[model samples]
Target: MDYIIKNEKLKLIYEPGKGAWTYHLRIPNSEHIEGKWGEIKVSGSIDDYKLESRNLALTKEGDKILSINNEIRTAINKKGGEGSNFNAYSQCSINCNFSLSVAIL
Candidate 1:
């Protein structure tokens, strides 16, 4: 089964195996991911990218993205509840990322 999580532009696709989960995150890139030959298409809006550029966390462009991503990961792990296998996914991560990346202008 697929556990899909997303907010606005970014999205994550999670596939759970017997003991592990495979993750596919759709992130904005300078070059858009195109669809052809069955390859997964990656795309983003410039406005969104610009907005992300304004995030206080990402202002300097160091490890903030990594930090943010980790925070999101942690949040996602916590979202599935305490006893329900905890194998679900959450789009809250995306919102967190977006909020951390919103533009001032």
Candidate 2:
């Protein structure tokens, strides 16, 4: 599922499961900015490590800002299962060593 943050002039869709990406952005009465999106990148020693977002919560929502938080983890292993395709499942197999909080204004 996608989380939406919006105000009178703009709208944003945050997709934590896909690399903590802001997958959609638009201004009112206008088309979404084609080919443009946002993402958060975390890197370290392991070049092939994958980052996943967990414990996503909307900590704040106000006229001036929107705050979202996630416990970030790198998937060391994964087990394919028959269930919802949320990335939190991948995070369940690892320990969270990073935290990310995003505030949009």
lDDT digits (tens) for residues 76-105 of candidate 2 = 222211111121111222332232222211
Candidate 1 TM-score, C-alpha based: 0.21
Off by over 4 Å in 1: 1-8, 16-21, 32-72, 77-105
Model 1 agreement with the true structure over 1-105: per-residue lDDT tens digits: 222222323334344551222333223331221222223211222222211221212212222221123344454442221111111121232323221121111
Q: Give the winner by lDDT.
A: 1
Q: Estimate each model's TM-score.
A: 0.21, 0.16
Candidate 1: residue 98 lDDT (0-100): 24
lDDT of each: 0.25, 0.24
